[model samples]
Target chain A: MEFLSYLISGISLGSVYAIIALGYTMVYGIAKMLNFAHGDVIMIGGYISFCAMSYLNFPGWLALILAMVVCTALGVVIEGLAYRPLREATSLAVLITAIGVSYFLQNSALLIWGATPKVFSPIVEGTQNIGGLSVSNISLLTMAACIVIMVVLTLFTSKTKMGKAMRACSEDKGAAQLMGINVNRTISTTFAIGSALAAVAGVLMCSAYPTLMPTTGSMPGIKAFTAAVFGGIGSIPGAFLGGILLGIIEALAKAYLSTQLSNSIVFAVLIIVLLVRPAGLLGKYVPEKV
Target chain B: MLKVNDINVYYGSIHAIKGVSFEVHQGEVVTLIGANGAGKSTILQTVSGLLRSKTGSVEFLGENLGNVAPHKIVAKGLAHVPEGRRVFLQMTVEENLEMGAFTRPGSEVDSGIADVYKRFPRLEERRRQIAGTLSGGEQQMLAMGRALMSKPQLLMLDEPSMGLAPLLVEQIFEIIKELHKAGTTILLVEQNAQMALSVADRGYVLETGKIVTTGTGAELLNDDAVKKAYLGA
Candidate 1:
């Protein structure tokens, strides 16, 4: 019974990581650049929702939507201002710029919100008992939200015309342009979708953990990145699977072994998986033909 | 009609195309036959807006294409089936065709796809299969079918027979002839001088980024210099 409880909570935690990992994977897949500041976007989302709900007395649902909109716009602006200029630069240079943007976001949050951690009220209150297992409403909601977003995203990518264009751009930017698909506009849309997912993850994470700080996104961001690499950086289903697997391993390690070693165990699993399959579980190896 | 006048293109420090000029009038199959590194692909790229010519003018249908973006160039009724086929490897044949009609109206896309299917029944058979899984000849067919989906008035083919069996090469040229008969203006670049000269109405011989000779297909096919340099006979 205790193991079942731990597994449930672990899945809930994994759902949050999956949501965030989706953003990272999608951006990496389409633009071929990792947005290191993605985690900071989550922190910003949480802060915005907190301020709106507490200070401005906005309703819970309205606050969530506001955070999503702000984060989406911020994502597009960041791509235009920071990443666009470096599109032709070396990947190392773009990566350094991403790290710089990440630090800048963290510093700005600190200046505005201070070092003190803020408490977040649960968006969904109470608990439900199912088959002798007591599940918090927030936990169930987090899982449901993750599943819903996944379905919608899958449908959007596979069915819509814009989605086809995005896939084409990811495959070959030059060919996509030849086909009359606007490469710049497609990349911008990818960033917008990624940042909005970060907002969703941020709100769910704060509700589950009930704490907010400038550095709150850092650990989750790293974990979600690990998840992306574990599942396959460019594969959507890979991100989802990698997040859950990492979460379960961490939870089990904390429960059975030392809690202090849980972080180490998570990374150990990544190294082992990478050794076996360098491209991640679902990633296909593409060779350059002469 | 498409006209390229005195176009000089540079790749950084290397002068790739130097003062190259050519004209393709409406409803004509024009072939540019050259040895490798003679700037055949560069000329096609410049006309497609992939590579900008530092000094020269490209006029397509009476409009200057000097500053048009690559995607906008497609909207102007010109389509480039780039070298290497460059098909969306991971996408299906049908999806590849859909992408070809990306600039067309949504309502017209289905019919465009249907037209491509009718042209290449092989594509219809493997429409659901990933493009990378298709054989080289099938991929070439898919690439041409994809370009046709755009309803292009002028279609540019860059080395459609780059690496194929001799029989497949013959079949591909036959299709090109068929397309020309169907009223599609074609700009063909090929290293296979014999086949290209046979099907083309007009021919230009390129040597070291310059048009060394221009004539009717029969005139160039029988030219003493062209036969010695390009044709084995």
Candidate 2:
């Protein structure tokens, strides 16, 4: 029963990582540049949701929707203002820009929201006794919501028009351009969708845990990024699997070993995975064109 | 018909295409033959809107293509089969073909794929295979097939015979002939001068990004200067 609780808790944590991983995967696949600011966007979403709920006095569901919209718009703006001009520049230039954007967002959040952690209203506040296991409704709901969104996202990418465009852009941007796909629009749309998913994750995360601060995104973002690389940065299914697997391992380690050792375990797994399968479990090797 | 009026293209400070100019009439196959770095690919890229000319005008069907986006150039009825056979590695052969017709309406897409299959029966046989796993010759066929799926009025092929075996080269050239006979206008760029000229209606010689000579296919094929520089006589 204790193990079951740990498993459930791990799954809930994994859901957050998967949501955040999408942002990292999509941008890296298209632009081949890691958007370090992605996690901050997740933080931004939570803050936006918090503001709507507290200051605007909006309903919980309305705040969720608004947070997604606002976060998506911010994602588009970030791409336009920071990424578009540097499209032709070196990868190093873009990497620095991404880091700069991240720092700027984090510090700005500190100025506006303060250094102290803020309280967020819980999405669910009760616990359920299932087969002698004490499980919070918040955890159950978070896991369920993650599963539902993952399915929708999979379908959206595999079966929809825009999804096809996004995949094409990732495959060969130059060829995709010849096919009459507006590469810029496709890339922008990718950012919007990835960030929107992160926003939903942020709200759910805040509701489940209820404590937030400016630096909150840094840890989650790094973990999610590790998940992205572990699963293959360009493979969606890989990201999901990697996230869940990482979360489960982390939970088990934390429960069995010292808390200090728990942090090292994640990186240890990453190093092992990298050694075993450098392309990642689901990643396909793309040879550089001659 | 297409008209390239004294276009100038640059890569940073390096002048790639210096005052290059040419025209391709409807229902004609035109070949541009040049050595490596002769701006052969650059001219095609400029015309297809992949790269903007530093200074020049590219008018296709009376519409100015200068400064237009790459995809918009495809909508304008120009399909470029790039130098390398850049088939989508992760996508299946059929999916790669589907992406080729992304801009076309759904109703037209099916027929487009069918037409491509009809032209390249090998693609139909390997429809479910991932494009990247194909051999170089097969990938070249798939690249051409994918481009044809777009149903372009004008098809521009860049070095279609680049890495093919001699036999495969002959086969690709035959396909080019078939496309021309089927009334698809073509602008072919190639270092394989003999095969390109044999298939083209007219030929242009590009030397250091400038069109040094232009004539009917046979005229250039038989010209003393062309024979000396390109034909290895």
Candidate 3:
């Protein structure tokens, strides 16, 4: 019974990681650069929701939506201001700039939200009995939300025109531009979508843990990034699979192994997987054309 | 329909194109032919707004294309089929064609794709297959068919016969002739002087980024200098 409960919670936590990983994966896919600041965007999302709910006395759904909206705008602005200018620059330069942006966001959040942490009320409370196994409502809700998002995202990328444009840009930016697709706009839209997902992750993660702080998103952001790399950095389904597996591993390790070593164990497993399959589980290995 | 005046382009310290000037009138099939590193592709790229000329201007359809984005250049009825057949390899053949109509109306995309499919029946046959899986000749055909989906008034083909079998090269030239007959103005850049000159209405011979000779296709094809230098006589 305890194992079942831990597994469900693990899935819930995995769902949060999956959401964050989606942000990382999508941005990297289209822009071909890691937005190291993605973790901070989640912190902003959590802060936005916390303010909306407690300070503004808004409903939970409204807070989520507001957070998503704010995060989307923030993502676009960050891409335009920080990443766009570096478009023609080297990968090392861009990577360094991303780290700078990450620090900027972290510090700004520190100035605005201060160092104190806030407790959160679960967005969906209570328990649900499933086949004689008890699952918390938040766990069920998180898992359900992840499934819905995965389905919608898959369809959006496969069926919609904008989605197709995104895929084209990822494949070849110069060719996509030649095809009359606006490469800049496609990249901007990707950042918008990614940050919106981060916002949802922020809210759900805070709900499960019931604590909100400026640094709340940093740790999970790193975990989800690992998950993204674990499953194949640019593959959507890979992010989800990696996140779920990561969550399960963490949960199981904490339950069975020493709690002090669970985080280390998670990272050690990632190193092993990468050594075995360097491109992650589903990453495509393309040879350089001479 | 297009004019490039006194253009100078540099790649870092290397002066790739030096004060080159050219123009293409409506309904004319113009060809730029040269040996490797003669700046034929550079001229096409500059005209398509991919590269900026430090000096001089490009006028297309009466509007000066001053720093217009490449996609906007396509929107203005100029489609460039770049060298090396840079097709979206992961996309299906049909999707690549659909992408070509990205600047057009959504309602007209189907018609545009239908027209391309009609022109290249091989593309229609492998419409559902990934572009990377296609043979070199098939990918080249797919690239040209995709550009046609844009329904541009002027089509710029950069080395259409590049890396293809001799038979495929003949077939591609035949299609170019057919497209010319269908009233699409063309700017062809090629190292295959014989094939390019055969289809060109007018030809410009570029040597080290300068126009060394200019004449009718037949005139250049028969010129002793052109024959000696490029025709490998």
Better TM-score candidate (2, 3): 3
Backbone collision tally, model 2 = 0
In candidate 1, how many Å is residue A206 off?
A: 1.1
What are the DockQ scores of the candidates, in order?
0.64, 0.65, 0.59
Per prediction, fnat is 0.65, 0.68, 0.57
**Model 2 RMSD in angstroms:** 1.6
Candidate 1 vs candidate 2: the lDDT winner is 1
**TM-score on alpha carbons, each prediction:** 0.97, 0.97, 0.98
Ranking by DockQ: 2, 1, 3
Top lDDT prediction, candidate number: 1
- Candidate 3 at B199: error in angstroms? 0.6
DockQ of 2: 0.65
Q: Which pairs of residues collide in model 3?
A: none
Sliding window of 10 residues with minimal summed lDDT for model 3 chain B: B129-138
Per-residue lDDT for A113 in model 2? 97
Evaluated against the true structure, the overall lDDT of model 3 is: 0.91
Candidate 1: give the clashing pairs: none
Residues A1-290, model 1: lDDT tens digits: 99999898889999999999989998998999888999999999999999989999888788889999999999999999999899879999999999998999899999999989999987778999999999999999999988888788778877799988988998999899999999889999999999999998999999999899999988999999999999999788888888888888888888888799999999999999999999998888754332
Model 1, position B76: C-alpha lDDT score? 94
